[model samples]
Target: MTALATAPTARPRPARAWRAVMRLHRPALIFWGFFVSVVSAVLLWAYGPGGNAAAAAWQRPCTVDLCDVGYAVDIYHLAYRFCEALITFLPVLVAVWAGGLLIGRELENGTAELAWSQSVSPARWLATKLAVPAALLTAGTTLLVLLHRLLFDAHQVPKGWNWSDNGTFEANGPIAVAFPLLALALGALSGLIAGRALPGLIAGILATATASTLIGLAGPHLVPWKTSVGDLKEGYAAPSGVIYGREGAVTSTGAHIPDPCTGAGKACPAAHDIVGYYSEYHPSSQFWALQLTQTALILTVAALATAAAFTLLRRRTS
Candidate 1:
């Protein structure tokens, strides 16, 4: 009884921390909720009424002069493009909020320091900062991704839509979820490094953009490319696929060389000692492999950024 009376009362630190975070970022939280709801509704409409109307428009018998595709196609196209663009660039938006408002503004305005003084270590503060947003971002992005996939898989998208297209590919897989987390991590690191809101916002955006660009460029090479070879008379014989890596003449000695007959209509393959033509590309079957590979890479970078942020925070505080 004496010990109990002398001891300090236990407190729910994590719950308190979570509540504090939510209260501080209430505006951003509201905006995020609204954004997700709007996109989800758009996707649902496209998947149901818009898709049916578009399908019916396509099925209409064509007159010689005009297809008469109707407004449904146009509306569906607009909806799809809007959703794709938003989902694809969701990370940049996250980066902006994170760097500008979440970490940078707090640090810039002495809010973080005040929190640290209130029996909350810098580590715990940072953890709450990252974890709360991370959870929300993950949930929201995952829902968007699933909706996008459902719409795409319904086979009602425009004719030119391909699984390998950048927006479609990212939105259709786990990379959609992974990228925003990366953006959040990057934003946090930028905020810690800059210690100011505006600079942190710019740096975070550039960093996330650069990382995304690099990953996109490397996506084609993430898996083994399928090759199709054909004799000179048959010309190039590659099947339809994404990322046509290489298309050139194949010599009898199995060496690759530039195709001399590419533009010349009557050029002889024999002049270039070309026995056949080869094309290297990624087939549709490689989609999952590529997506998973990119997701792993992005997550790895996010982890590194998170570690760097903690290290920077510790150095500053210590």
Candidate 2:
């Protein structure tokens, strides 16, 4: 009797906040898992059976006038396009999930408040929410990027689908992982600002879209753009075979010039004193450099957004 009376009760364990987060967003998790599985299967098919079919189709000479100008729409090409679109649009999907299905729904339905009331700090709750999904997103995107690079290296890519291509560059490197994280961070910030489901969803999508547009516009300037000066009469062609940048005329004295004429005529050549042209481009050798630089910038933006989110949560909770 004395032992029973003096015995201490075991304290209840702290709530498993991460597990609660997973439970709250189980549907989104399921969808993401299904999507990753399907994409992995498609990529594997591209590397295996589809590759053989595409190779066979490429060997057949074209009898028509078009000839090799256009390759046949083979299974491999289809798979390649599928991978491109999948990696490219992944960020948007992340935005939607983070906004509507994660925080938006919780905030709208008062579940966030309820969770905070039940022994969970707002910051910790939000951190768990962001951290789990971010880990999964990073893993999924990195796997897809690796598979994409493998497939691209093993076969002949379409003329415009090289490393210099926008979709190709994004899908083949760390940018694939970084961009989704940026979208997720932006989505969370949007959700906190809007505080309602539909509005938050819309805001998140728009925010992601805006970030993408800004990046597209500003990306070229971020890296060291190589300017190749060549004879105007000889015409300028990229030495590296990849030219994803602007071209304009330059004088013998290295002064910048603008061409007034549109068509290729004698007047067009003489109008701007165009002795030569400068082609600003990123060479194939700079692929990894540009990718790493862009990734760092994107991650920085993500970090800022995440910090802002915590601050916002703190203010609201306080």
Candidate 3:
């Protein structure tokens, strides 16, 4: 009788907060990450160097006066290659949208009061909610970067370049790494502050886009010069070739100079800034320090911005 009366009750299991988060934002997450991956792969395969047979074009010496340039790789490969490169930014976008969606939506809807009334602490609830999406973003980023590196290597395409074409690569910079994370963090905060999911997500995307533009704009001065045309001799030419040194971003009058990079029968001394375009090195080398320092500075700015955001998050809000 006593055993029956005093039967112990089993403790209720703690609900996995991440499960709810995943259920809520699964569509957006998938759309941003996996969808991008699949589309990128298809685009690359169909129009990229990987499937040249699919994108083949007949090319021969131009018989007509003022015909197109020589037979070379199709421009589609370059275009598709840039499209696939968008993968690098997907993680940040997904992160911002997913992280900020629910929290803000709930707050806007007044559902968060019910949650607060329950046993969950705001920080713990937030952490659990952010975890699942963050894991997915991390996974997406790793897979995308790896796949890109492998595919670019296979295709012999220029794998890394400043997305902004600012003459530097941000593949190793904190801006590239932090951009999406900043978006997610901002989105999550927006969810809390913006009071609705749609607003939060939009805010996340806007903030990320703005930051990306800044990074891209700043990329040209951020990396080492992969050899400048000005660094080359005035009439330098490769062996058995009549091509000479290219003119750089000199502030000379645009009175149409000869094309130095041209061949004997082709145009010569064409006055144009051919600096930082080719993947070639020049003589009298000694520009490594400038590039390295620039990279460090830009990356430092990115890191500091992220740190400031986190620091503010840790503070008590009114």
Give each model a TM-score.
0.91, 0.91, 0.58
Order of quality (lDDT):
1, 2, 3
Instruction: Give all candidate RMSDs, comma-separated.
Output: 3.5, 2.8, 8.9
Relative to the true structure, how large is the alpha-carbon lDDT of every model? 0.90, 0.82, 0.49
What order do candidates take by TM-score, descending? 1, 2, 3
lDDT of 1 by residue, 204-240 (tens): 9999999999988887788888989999778889876
Candidate 1 minimal-lDDT segment of 10 residues? 1-10
Of 1 and 3, the candidate ahead on TM-score is 1
- Can you list the residue pairs that collide in candidate 2? none
Task: Give me candidate 3's TM-score against the actual structure.
Answer: 0.58
**lDDT of candidate 2 over 1-318, digit per residue (tens):** 456456688999975877877787888889889988988888888888777666667666788665562343455777888888988999998898788768887899999998899898899889998999999999988899989888888875344356777688889899999999999999998889888878888888998899888876777678888877778666665576564678777776788666454477777666666687777788888888888888888888889989999999999999
User: Which portions of model 2 miss their true places by more than 4 Å?
Assistant: 1-7, 61-73, 156-160, 239-241
Which of the numbered candidates is closest to the native, going by highest lDDT? 1
